[model samples]
Target: MTQQTTLHAAFAGHVAAALDALKAAGTLPAGLSRAAVAVEPPRDPAHGDLATNAAMVLAKPAGLNPRALAEALVTELAKIPSVTAAEIAGPGFINLRLNAAAWLDELRTIAALGNDYGRSTVGAGTTVNVEYVSANPTGPMHMGHCRGAVVGDALASLLEAAGHKVIREYYVNDAGAQVDVLARSVHVRYREALGENVGDIPEGLYPGEYLIPVGQDLAREFGDKYAAAPDSEWLALFRNRAVAAMLVMIKADLALLGIHHDLFSSEAELQAAGKPDEAEAWLRAHDLVYDGHLEAPKGKTPEDWEPVELPLFRSTKFGDDQDRPIKKSDGSWTYFGADLAYHFQKAQSADALVDIWGADHAGTVKRIKAAVAAMTGAEGKPTPFEVKLVQMVQLMKGGQPFKMSKRAGNFVTLADVVEMVGKDVVRFTMLTRKPDAQMDFDFDKVVEASKDNPVFYVQYAHARIRSTLRKAAGEGMAPSADHLELLGEEELGLIKLAAQFPRLIEAAAAAREPHRVAFYLYDLAAALHGYWNLGNDRPEKRFIVAQDINLTGARLYLATQIGQLIRNGLALLGVEAVEEM
Candidate 1:
């Protein structure tokens, strides 16, 4: 069993013992259930390692004074093997101090588990689909998409570490008007590459210079043979080629951020290849799709507003604010229709579905969730769908706002940020903030070699441990796991922090907030760094003493465990745990 389970079991045993003692002493009502009893870490560490609310919860239910019940429970808990002491204080809290040997055992478990120390089977092999960074394949990824990519990738890794069979997916928006604009953009570039003065790109078309090579490829492939043909005949070919090229560029951009999707579901493929038809049939079978007209959006007026009957989905019946249309007035499928079909396909395959989208799509959440519920006929019940909306990231340099314009072709690409600060730093910094909160990415501060830079601080702690190991090896001292018991107070404190890793993973995965991992790593790194700095003042506190080889060996073992944990945590964030600065 994991250390957390063992700790929980020990706490449960204590609670059980306390309940029995209360019954035996006749200080509490008989047959009172101890189900609400809980043992967790105290907000203040000085109180104790673990605090129980047994008395506080049972006071009124059992018709006993909280302090009197706490006192009796403390006496009962003192007999437990894992709990060294139990004290009753402040009305009803039963603070239990664990035996040092329990922590030592935890250290041994961590050492045995090594990199897998924090892994959990909470997901129990269930299938989960994590769709993220479904950026339109019309250009390279911009800075806005970078944060979502990192957050999604980290969340997938976090869930996988919790033992879920996760499939990372990316949706390709290839059948939309965006791709048509891309085709035109590439055609402009093609003419320019073929010695023709394309002049200025037309309004409402992509004008980025990145498409120059794509145009060159198009020119080389067709050689003006289809230039005279109508757009209908050549548009499809050009759109496909441009999308393929754009997707390649997009993949490269994701690679720069250390992200790669397992599946790339295409919108055009779904429509042209019978998937949408299948989805529509499924929805019709469920009585979710029908022919109707939607009310124009309220509280806002559009210049080209017109009312017309259209094919609609009864999203309101499933919990949306109102029914949503699946087809436009002109008989073309709306974006929402394709989205519903995509989600339908996902729901059919996976046990759970999670979509990571930008905050701009905040209004889209209710409609999508409603669509999922309507299709499944699971209204008023929880569905296996979660939408993680990531707010925008504002990039800054030296405390000033930094803006990039793609129109000017001077936008900060994902590649630019990754190339400047590295994939590890970029990933780590992006996740330091919660997904729903806006994040500020400062180019200068992120790479600074100081404590203010959390990425460097955590990495420095890991590197310091490595440095200690190197010093021990140079001095011919053994650094094996067997000598871990000789660890000092500072070393043991670090072990306690390491023991919390599995619990952290489980909590972060259950909460669906990967920022918890970042926070936990920061705390663990701080503990290690604090202990490392203690060596600066006291010679004996040094991990490698000149004359104490046995002590050095034990300290090295502790340091190795810390290094392993840092490496594992960094791996979860898709960050590199470097051995050197």
Candidate 2:
């Protein structure tokens, strides 16, 4: 299929053609790279409809002054029928102002493409595996894991929208000491379910009341079969069952926020397959692993520090602070050891890998990154990889910290928040800030009807458009493209803003930042609301005109397209574009 041409893309081709013309006419040098050439809207609308740094970006390499290059470029661009004016701006930036007909044509593009309007092929032929919300299978999902969950899921969808095959994955940390702790915690609850006074959750085990049901099921099933047995007789059974139960709860919690992963990999399964052993042998053969002793950790008293010989991966070779141990002194794999194998496994089927982790894992980012680089680069096709750390979210209400849920035992469960405010609000609110920045999820402000509330404001824009279209239809007027030329300056201005969606999607996908979608949607919504306000003072400007069916169809056409674009964007964020408030 031929790619649908967007306004930004069309003008980008024009700028490139202009440069090519300069080269062909012997006015400029040949073979200059156009990698840095970009077409985007001017920062201020008053500047122009669209601006390009083609002249400015090419001037230095082409050895011509920016202003001179811009002038020549403007002369070439002025030949295009759609470009009414092309002018040189500050330094060498060239800005183009198109006639209203150009934008009205783009509004037609929105109608032709509908849901496919903003889709881009920027990431075509690349497969990205996004691993996120790998919260340990020890307890219920909570606000602590919320930000990364929403960010990662939305990012996966954004990549898909940008034309990449995305694998939405979750790594189950059902291995090492943590799951064992979870198993024992369930055992304590099991005895309690069996009418034994297990007492107030002994230290060093999960104490969440969410485990009560799991323990009750186990008690009813086993009927004291392993209640008094030694740890060797029942540890594995309880561990497997407990992890499965916790995962069920975790999945349910994530579902409440509209999240579902395509794959949930198990650490224990990876180890049982001897993947870690396989990774070690290959790294050692490549000299990326060696037996070494780590220096005493920082802040440890010299008298308290002990050095032990262990097999360490040469992570320092790839920019880590130091070589890292791959195995404990007792010959068991370290968490980093298993993690390295897991990353290598993920690199097998993907062109790139992305991990969304909590800020608490900040300290481990480098070594794991180093391992991935070494492991994948060795195969002569280095895979692309990135780790995004989502910072903490403080839950607040009534101007202070919201109390934790007793059912969750301590923290505010994700389910608790979603139930209180609805799934759309929780997901949208989680994405209001960048993943790396700290944010507060305030119960009071998030649901407020004011424009300051991004979720409410953006959704209100879509709802208003739908209401307008419905009212117009009732009066026998419907959206049409027959009189699109009737759309005026204010209407064209809205199209100019809507026209940026294609560019925004590509840029956001390239940057791996999904929050940009949220920010852009809010701006578009603001433009819609601002245009609607203009109609309050001018009846002819309203979307519906009983006396002017042709003009009303044109205006309603504009509103319908705007609403469709909003729905397209909201879907990428896994949010709902409500037809009514």
Candidate 3:
């Protein structure tokens, strides 16, 4: 077991023993429920290290005042070996002070686990599918998709660290009208490359210099064969070729951001292969499909509405406001239909599913959940699916809003952001806020080496540890793991921060929020920085000394453990912890 597991186990054992003692003493009624009791860190450090709500939760049922029950429980808890002091405070909280030896022992466990210090088995081998960055293959990824990519990838890594069998997926919209536009766009560039003036891109067409390369490749391969052919003859081939080339470029761009997916499901391939029909069959088998016309959207003018008879999913049966159509008026499946098929595939394959989408799709969440519930007959029960909507990210430079427009053809791509601030800075900055909260990415501030820049602050903490280790090596006083027990208060504080790693991982994975890990790393880095500053005021507190090799070795061990934790935490977020900033 990891150090965090050991610590939590010990703490839980002590709490359980206290409850048992309360039972034996007859101060508490027999057969009183004990499952709701919880032990967690105190909100105020001065209260004690940890606090429990056993007395507060039991007071009304036990017919006793909360403080009286807390006082009685505190007396019972004082007998446990792991608890140094137990005090009652604040309505009914039982505060716990752990023995100093327990904190010291955690340092040894950190040395043993090293970089794997915070790994856990909470997921217990369940299969989970995380889908994100499903940007259409028609164009390169832009700044908007970067946040979802980083958040999803980091969440996947966090789940893996917590022992989930995770599969990262990308859904490609290769069967849409956008792909047709891309083919037409590439054809214009193809004609231009062949010395033909395809003047002024027509309406409803893409105009970007990036497509010029695709045109050149097509010209070199086909050699004027499709150059003069009719659109009906070559449109499919051209669209397929252009989409293939664009997807390669998109994959390279995602690679620059350190994102790799285990699977890429194509909409075109699924449609051509009758996957939607199979999904409809499954829905029919479950009595979820029907032939009906949707109610025209409310509060809209008649000209803005189009009503048609179509095959519909009985989504309203599962709490949706209205049933949704699976096929469009043209008898082709809508994007929503494809999405239903994709989720059906996921439900059949994985034990759980999570999707990260842009905030524009927030309205789609209810219908999708309703469809899932209707398909699985799990109404009013939790489904193994969740969708997280990522809010917009506004890019700024020097306190001014950066402008990007498709008409100008100068939109900032993900590659541009990666090239400007580097992948580590981009990933960490994108995750500094919750996924649902809006984030501002200031080009000037991220690259700055100040405490205001969280990425630099955390990286600086790791670099400072390396500096200490270098100084120790120069003085021939590098500490060994065996001497870590000689650490003092500051060193023990650093060790305590390291010991919180596994617990943080468990919490983050359970919450499905990678931003929490980013916040925790910043806090841990602050602890290290404060400890390092202490050495400047007290010479005896320095991590290295030429006169005492044993003391220096102990301090070095402590510093090394802190460095390992910073690196591990940053790694989980797909950020880099540099030895030198």
Candidate 4:
């Protein structure tokens, strides 16, 4: 698709052209780095519509006084066709105000693009592999996994909106002690299904009743075949089936949140294919891995822990706390070792990699980062990889801790929470805060209809817009750009807020923070709602002025674009634009 230039993009060009003109006139030197120069909304709305520090940024390099440079930029900036006022703020900052036509032109751009209005081309030609919700395939997905799943899925969608080809992936950790425990737990349930009193769950085995169904299915299929069999005979089979069953449950839980992955990479398959061995051999050959004895961990004593010489990755070279082992003493891949290989495989196919992990895994982040850098650098092309840590969500109901799920064994299941609120509420509320901060998913607040609830407020704004449009259509009125010149300053100001979506998308994607999209949409909704209230007291400000057909069309058109922008932003967060709150 051909990219439409946003108002921010257009004005950015005007700023660049003004600087280029300055250089051409011998007022500033050519070839100086202009990367530091930025054109953005001023901090205080009273200052101007848009502001730039071009004068301050280029003055020292150009050998001119800041005040003199500001005057020259303002003089050149005022010559732009759409720019109406250009003035120098304190400390040589240049602020430019555009005529109504400039904003009207942006309103038209929104109409022309429709659904693709805020889509950006900044991430064009880049492929990002986003891996999220890599929970162990041993139990049903619970609240612990919910936040990361939503964050990761939304981030992937945000990146795609920013013009990157994104591969949504989930790493299934099937080869581990946890799965073995799950297999054993399933075996116990299988015996219980065969009419054996397994009694209370044996210590060290999964105690969740969620495993009962898998066991019952096995009992019906195999009769008493595995019930009396040895652990060696049924352990692997049960492990595989149990993991598969848990994954089915996990997928179902994620589906409720409207999340799905493009790939489900298996840790077991990676080991079966010798991928970890391949990584280890390459690391050893490059001197990044060596047979080294690890230093004693802090506060450990002889009775508690002992240092063992093993195949350790020299992670300290990359600023990690210490070297990390790739393999345990028993010749099995350590978690980091297997994970290193997993990241290596991912990097082989994508331009960059992103992992959304629970904050509990923060300690491992440094070691894995160092390992990726070392292994990928050895190939002479280091891959860009980042790990975003999501904090745990504290579920609250009735101003107290919510009850746990019986099906999930102990913790609250994601499906249960989703069923209570809904997919849209679950997904949108998850992004209401930064991922790294502690968040409370209060059942009451999330479903509250007050503006204090962000999802409700944003959705209510869209619903109001849709309701207005339907009313207009019933009255034989429709949106039009023909009378936009009659749109007042307040209307244009509302359009300016709506027009920030494209730039917001680019900035949020670059920062890999999808929460910013949530914040921006809330502010935009507030702006639209505030403008709609303007009509309550002033009849002329109402969207449908029956006596004035031309003005009514233009006002309706403005409301339509604002609604469209909210829809676009909501789509990025995996939220449905509600027609009725």
Candidate 5:
């Protein structure tokens, strides 16, 4: 078998070189733009090895019919060393078949690169700020926040693999009304800790009993110091303390899923630093904000709805249905007001900003985008601000909805799910579907070892590869490229699947969907398992061919490369690749 360089990159280079030759030979028009030329594997494997759309894309511009252009390009492309056969297929598409050595060379590249096989430089030098799992620090994280946390973390890893400088961030909503309720709830327990009968938790306050510990801690820290003080005197002090404590609990819950943010931006801190005031003044000067009366929002008209003149952001000018309020009737800054300031601050240092939010916040996406546009004067242009609305997740056990938690709160805590099925299983299961689609996380199914369980199927494949390698090593066998020709079509098929890893990473990173990596790993695992099953019926296909050490070494090398791919993919998803079941 002949040697080759990287598959996709090599083919792309050949296509460019072929186009340049066409221009040089005067057969095609000089100055023809090669931007539209694309080389990719054909959808159907039967259509040669790789396909190009150069003919179709440049035909009209070259003043030649597509078929004519294809014929001309085919003549030059067939001269390349790797192109054993070049043929024109449907509608001017040129399919090129490479020699068997090209596929074998790809396998060699995977083994040499190891874990860095799929790393790409598509996003090199770009700074991306991914803000995810910004669950209000009012209590422990619940099941609703699980998917966003996993997706955000996975996307951050994927971007890093694509050579982007990524910062994983969490926006703590400490200045909001929810934190006030949390403070009041903790204050009730604080009063009870001081030997006063605070009675049952009042309505409209945080009813979760998790605050009992925080209340007891506060009591111990300041023994009855402000137990009888008015809320005006203790609200700020208690709010600060409660927010700090709740953030610790939230961080612990995230750690249960192996998620840790590089930064935790606080709305309270931003406001305290005068960022919101500065943003407001900047918007007013730009005429993006003004005093205006707002129409009643569609569908739900509040009973107290009135045309009160408030400081309004002209979101409608940028595509929102109506202008949005920056301050409420009570003169306090609204949540959106603080969010705009935070996003603007983030945009100062980042080339791109991504926010992972729950689907319930879909309506706010457009206005937030509009606010970023107004702040940066990037209206009608591509702005770095993007909000990914993650649909909800339903936690299940067996065939029914699961709802037991140590906190006994309205939703199951993330820590509870992680404790039940392990961090790897929880993270992998959450990523099985796209963020926009709702999914059910079944506790029983996720832990199963059957093929129906994606996580188990993938982990089992990696473990089986590792086990085989260990047994091979026990017999003094190691991976070698000397006898790769012993591999047949079945083995080459597996290598082809592995070769898609780099392309997959680039596509998934550009699309900002890390779930694709999980799906690709599942497919690769299936290829490994299906090939292994063949050895059950035909012992000759077994990896450990005892009679010939050279053949055994080649098969072991193939198996090792597959394992490396699975491990690299699982690492991106923050899931551990197990060596054993």
Candidate 6:
């Protein structure tokens, strides 16, 4: 079903219809604005089940006071079959309470839709390119890359769930000074593999031991053939081999977290294809770039600073602090220039673009946004572009700082964390916090089978529900809606929480935040557990009441629906819901 037909959407439409009724009665102006009206769950459940700002949003335009408009709107809203009460609060806000039967119907919808209950058409199938975890192809991915990788993958999934055609992409930084260092490091290990005693790695080069295997492979194929050659003679050959091998390890690291990119765009390939040159010419034709000398950088000046003309993009016109240099004095493209070209090429196929970057690149957002605006301007239409800067994750074990990885030189590798805990834990924990906030991932806490561990807690709730269903099935007690009318407050409360999933998924996808799904799952699990504990004091509240088959069927239906909702939520986060934890 379309999002516009959901329960919440129906209420929003009711609000609009009420406004139109007021307009028909000439109680409100003909051109009253309803665009700002929002129908959503109130911040405090005690306020009401759902609240709307219809009166407050349109009062001034309608030439009526807020309370006056609210009073008029409530009359029409209360006429809705499911709306039992509509009350005007403190100034103008209208709070609504739907009958308990409304939530029961929502539970029926969940069972009918099953896994597709939360899917939405909010994105309208717009093509979006999500480029993330573009970690340099010089070594295995470290902990620093974990957050963005998970966030990007989850966001892509979320967008698709919201009906966006999303392309998961990884831009490989294969052409740069760093890859040269990787090649040199691999050459050192190659010499050692050829029976030459290579000393300690130099200070400026990569010192990771992960390259030892790559070196051994090279030696096995061509034993010391390039070991004694000049640096110029073997640099390109070694760089290509090293980059290819490192990418293999990188892809494997991503696999550990259940991530796979639909495309791996290479900077080297773009440069070789002269895309950067084309971007420079395009910007030049638009007068977006010009040969200019920049002033000394603020707060710090290099000792070798000198005035020299360079091809620069007028990023200052598009909200950047200063004009950005696109080409160096040597007529070579800068990193930003190559990145701009890549984005330009991406914009050709996708209607929107999103980049998941480390927080360190926060300073780079404006320049890239400026470049996107310039490139998309040529097409005579604005394309949506966003950069999500993911903060770092601090790893801990036993309450002490945990930081060391031979594969990544000095930092903890993503594979290391995934191996310590399973992929599901790693992914859910990464999404526990918003991407812009710094978080601590304690190894000990995530694996604990307690309420404090969100992933385990949510998984356990699903498992418990499944176990209850299995017990009922063994006794020939299948879920039946014959006694659905017997469900009470606790049952309806759980259903209300489950009903929010479709709305929550749409909002999270629009906001590009997957952590909302995590938070919602936590709340849903808590609601289920709360109702489950109620069975301790009130045995009649339990799912499998042997004495009353009808009640047992009803509670079992609720339990099965809750399990389905939890499973659907976990799927969005790329976490599996196990039948047994």
* Candidate with best TM-score: 2
Please state the error at residue 4 of candidate 2 in Å. 3.6
Lowest lDDT sum, 10 consecutive residues, model 2, at: 1-10
Candidate 4 has an lDDT of: 0.90
**What is the TM-score (0 to 1) of candidate 2?**
0.95
lDDT of 4 by residue, 274-393 (tens): 999999888888888999888777898889887778998999999897888898989899999999999999999999999999999999999999888887786577898999999999
Question: 3 or 4: which has the higher lDDT?
Answer: 4
Q: Write the per-residue lDDT of candidate 2 for residues 476-509, one digit (tens) a residue.
A: 8889999998888889889998999999998898
lDDT of 1 by residue, 1-581 (tens): 35445444446566877787768778887877776776667778788887889999999988778998788888888887877779887999988888777877776666777777788787999888999999999888888899889888999999999999889999999999999988877778887887888888888888788899988887888788666667887788889999998889999989988899999999998888766667677777767788776666676466656678876787887678788888777777789988988898887778788999999999989999988776654454444888999998899999999775544264678877787788888999998888899889999999999988999989988888887777667767857656666777778778767877776787788777888888888998899888878889998987887787777777777788788889989999988888888
Q: How high is the lDDT of residue 38 in model 2?
A: 92
lDDT tens readout by residue for model 5, 159-228? 9999899999999999988888988888998988888987778989888888898889889998998788
Each candidate's lDDT (Cα)?
A: 0.82, 0.92, 0.84, 0.90, 0.89, 0.89
| Sort order, lDDT high to low | 2, 4, 6, 5, 3, 1
TM-score of every candidate relative to the true structure: 0.87, 0.95, 0.90, 0.94, 0.94, 0.94
Looking at model 1, the pairs that clash are none
RMSD of each: 4.2, 2.1, 3.4, 2.5, 2.5, 2.5
Q: Give the TM-score comparing model 6 with the true structure, all chains together.
A: 0.94
Least well predicted 10-residue stretch by lDDT in candidate 5: 1-10
Clashes of 5: 0
How much lDDT does candidate 2 score? 0.92
